[model samples]
Target: MSTATPAHSSAQSGTAAIQSATIETRDWLIAAAAAIVALIALYAVFMDNGSLISATGDYLHEFAHDGRHLFGAPCH
Candidate 1:
């Protein structure tokens, strides 16, 4: 009185596992990229002394001046 079928094979399960791994890897890559970008932005705001964005003149420096002071970054 069994109603089991052989349609769901090991190959299909393997493919599904691979797809799940790929999605997890993609999510990790995205998170890593976002963290790197955030670190760069923090450097520009707190540690950069016009070297990171020298092409943009003093715009970034002036914009983040108060923030730098607030965070004790020694902008002076």
Candidate 2:
């Protein structure tokens, strides 16, 4: 025998709890910008070979070198 229950139970028998949240257009834009920045950073960390930000010299390469090797990317 088994009993079934909703994941979230409320004081009201038939109604699930509702939590109200709002995100403005500005907030969405900011979040999108942040996501893009994060993706760019990830690409720089993993796929960049001193071309995207070559002004930084080999700093980025050396910084993420161990990470590349750890992820089994052939740096040689």
Could you give me the TM-score of model 2 versus the true structure?
A: 0.59
TM-score, each model? 0.78, 0.59
**Residue-level lDDT tens digits of model 2 in 1-76:** 1233443343443342222123355678899999999999988887788788769877787899999889876674
Q: Write down the worst ten-residue block by lDDT for model 2.
A: 13-22
Per-model C-alpha RMSD: 2.8, 9.9
Alpha-carbon shift of residue 69 in model 2 (angstroms):
1.6
What candidate 2 gets wrong by more than 4 Å, as runs, is: 1-23
**Cα deviation of 26, candidate 1, in Å:** 0.7
Each candidate's clash count:
0, 0
lDDT of 2: 0.72
The lDDT of each candidate is 0.85, 0.72
Q: If candidate 1 were superposed on the true structure by all CA atoms, what would the RMSD be?
A: 2.8
List, residue by residue over 8-45, the lDDT tens digit for candidate 1.
55668889999999999999999999999999988888
